[model samples]
Target: MSIAIIGPAEIEAMIDREVADYPTDTRAGAQTLEAFQNARRKPRLVSVNFSGGITQKCYSVTRPNGDYRVIYLPLAGYFSLCVESDFGPLDIGVHGPAIACFGSV
Candidate 1:
C-alpha cells in the first residue's frame, strides 16, 4: 500500500471531527473531561510550548517497534499525536478525547 500525506487544513478538519464526537451534556463527555484532568495530574507527561502562551501536555512513548508522542490540550478539548521523522517531529492528525488518546499507555 502507498502512503498518503495530508496538509494542515486537512489535519484541522480531522481534529474538528474528533472533538465533535462527544457532547458535554452526556456522561461519556463528562468522563472524557475527567480523563484529561487525570492525565494532567501525572508527571509522566511533558510540557510543550504552544502558540498564544498555551502549555500543551506531551508524552513520548517508546516501544520495541517504534516511538510516538502524545499531546493534550485540555482547554481546547483535544489530543494529538506526533512521530519522529527525518525532518523533525511530524504531527499526525490524531485528535480525540483523553481515553482515546492516552488510555492505551
Candidate 2:
C-alpha cells in the first residue's frame, strides 16, 4: 500500500509551537529550529511495518535535542509523534484524523 503523510500544516504548526519554547535569539534554539525546518522539508523515511495486514510508515527528523518520529497509519488516516530522548521513546501524542483511530488501532 502507498503511504501518505497527513496534515502537514497542523504538524508544522505543532512543531513550531514546541520549538517556540526556546528563545529564538539563542544559538541552540536557532539551530534546533533550523533542523526542524530542514526535517519538515525533507523528512527521512525510517521504516515500514506491517501488523495484522495493516501498514505503517515511520519518518524521522533529527534535531539538536532529540529525534522526532512521525508515524503515519494510512489505513486509519492517522499520524502520531514519537520523540526520542536519553530515557527512551516518548509518545508526544496523535495528530490528524480522529480519536476513533486510536480505538481502532
Candidate 3:
C-alpha cells in the first residue's frame, strides 16, 4: 500500500515495531534497522508479493499476518530479515551453519 494511504503515523508505527523487535546489540542489527527505516522513509520500489507456500528447506517460519521465513545467523548474532522469496525459505542462501530442512511450512 502507498504511504499516502497508510498515513505517516501508521508507517512510523510499523517502522518502530520492526526496530523494537530486533535487538540492537549487534552492528548488523543496527545497520539493518537503520537501512530499513531509511528505506521506508524514502521508499523507492513497489513491494512484490511472492506466491506459493514453502515446499522445502526452512530454518524457521511464521504467519502473523503473512508468511515469513527467518534464519538465525549465529555469528551475526541475529536472525536474517524475514523475507518472502521466490524460493521461499530456500532463498536464505546455502552457506553458513544454517538450519536445514526438507518440508513445507
Candidate 4:
C-alpha cells in the first residue's frame, strides 16, 4: 500500500500538541516543530510514504491519514524519527546529542 495524504491543518495540530506537551521543553521540541512546519511550506524533493516502510523523509508519517508518524507515549520526552530508504536510514534523531557536542562544527 502507498502512503496516505493528510491536510496541513492536521499536521499543524499534531505539531502543536507535540510542542505544548513535550516534557522538559527542550530545544528538540522547538526545532522538531519548526522542521515539520518548514517541510510543509516547500515543495518536497521527495514524497513521504509508508508502503516501503519509511521509503523516505518525503513528509509526515501518519497512522491512516498520511505517512506521518506520531509518537505519543508516557514519559517519552523525545521524539525519535528516522527516515529509511532502500539503502539505509536517512535521518536519525538519536545522534542529536552527539551532533551538539561538536562545538560550531
Candidate 5:
C-alpha cells in the first residue's frame, strides 16, 4: 500500500467538517472539537504495542472531553484520530501519506 502524507491545512479542514457535523453545545460535538484542538497542539507517539508480534504505535493526547488516540501507519501513510466520548467513540480515518516513510518523526 502506498502512503500519502496529510498536510496541516487538510487536517484543519477535516476538523472543521467534523465540528460542523454536530452542534458545539452538545457533549458529542464539544468533545469532537476538543479532540481536534488537542491534536492540533502536538501529537506524540505515546506507546508501541507489539501484541502477537504485530507492532502498532499509539499516538495520543489528553483533553477535557477524553483521551485522544491517533493510529498512524507511516508505511501506509494512513491515520485515524479518535476519542472516547459519553455517547461513544468519535473517529476520523483517512488515507494520505505525502512524505511517506516509516519510523517516528
Candidate 6:
C-alpha cells in the first residue's frame, strides 16, 4: 500500500485556517488533534467502505509515526488517520444506520 502524506503547504494552510487562533504552545493543538483521532478510531467490520461509513473489509495497518488504517472508500480515495488510543470499547457509526447498506467497485 502506498503511504499517505499531507504536504507541508497543505498542513500549514489547515493550521492557519483551522487552528490559527490557538496559542503558540503546540501542547494544546496536539491534545486537540489526539482527542479527535481517539474519537474517530472505532473498529468495525468494513468491506465496501462508503464515502463516510463503516465496513467489514478488515484492514491491516502498520505505521509507527502513527498507527493508521487506509480505507478505500466509495469516493474513490483513501483516508488515512492516526489510530485510536482511547481506553474504552469502540462504537461504530454509519451514515445509513437503519438498513445496513453496502457498496463496491
Winning candidate number (lDDT): 1
Q: Name the lDDT of candidate 1.
A: 0.46
Q: Identify the leading candidate in terms of TM-score.
A: 5
Q: For candidate 2, what is the TM-score?
A: 0.33
Which one wins by TM-score: 5 or 6? 5
Question: What digit string (tens of lDDT, one per residue) describes model 2 on residues 1-105?
Answer: 774545545544544565556456978657655554554543344444342443344444332234554544334455555556554334455555221212122
Q: TM per model?
A: 0.33, 0.33, 0.30, 0.31, 0.36, 0.21
Q: Is candidate 1 or candidate 3 better by TM-score?
A: 1
Summarize candidate 4's per-residue lDDT along 11-99 as a digit string, tens digits.
44555664466444678656654454443332222433333455443332322113223221112222233344554334443322211
State the lDDT of candidate 5 residue by residue for 1-105, as single tens digits.
Answer: 555665545544544564466457878557655545554433345433332534454433223234444444444445544445543334434223211111112
Q: Please, what are the lDDT tens digits per residue for candidate 3 over residues 1-105?
A: 322234334434543565577666989657755544443332111222223542322223222124433343322323333455543433443332211111122
Error of 1 at 97 (Å): 7.1
lDDT of each: 0.46, 0.45, 0.36, 0.36, 0.42, 0.31
TM-score order, best first, reads 5, 2, 1, 4, 3, 6
Worst 10 residues of 1 by lDDT: 58-67
Error of 2 at 41 (Å): 2.5
Off by over 4 Å in 6: 1-25, 42-75, 80-105
Alpha-carbon runs more than 4 Å astray in model 4: 1-4, 25-45, 48-80, 83-105
Query: At residue 73, what lDDT does model 4 achieve?
Result: 15
Runs in model 5 with CA error above 4 Å?
7-13, 25-28, 31-40, 56-58, 61-70, 73-105
**What is the number of backbone collisions in each predicted candidate, taken in the order shown?**
0, 0, 0, 7, 5, 8
Q: Tell me the tens digit of each residue's lDDT in model 1 across 16-78.
A: 564566467988767764554443322234555543544444443312114454554434445
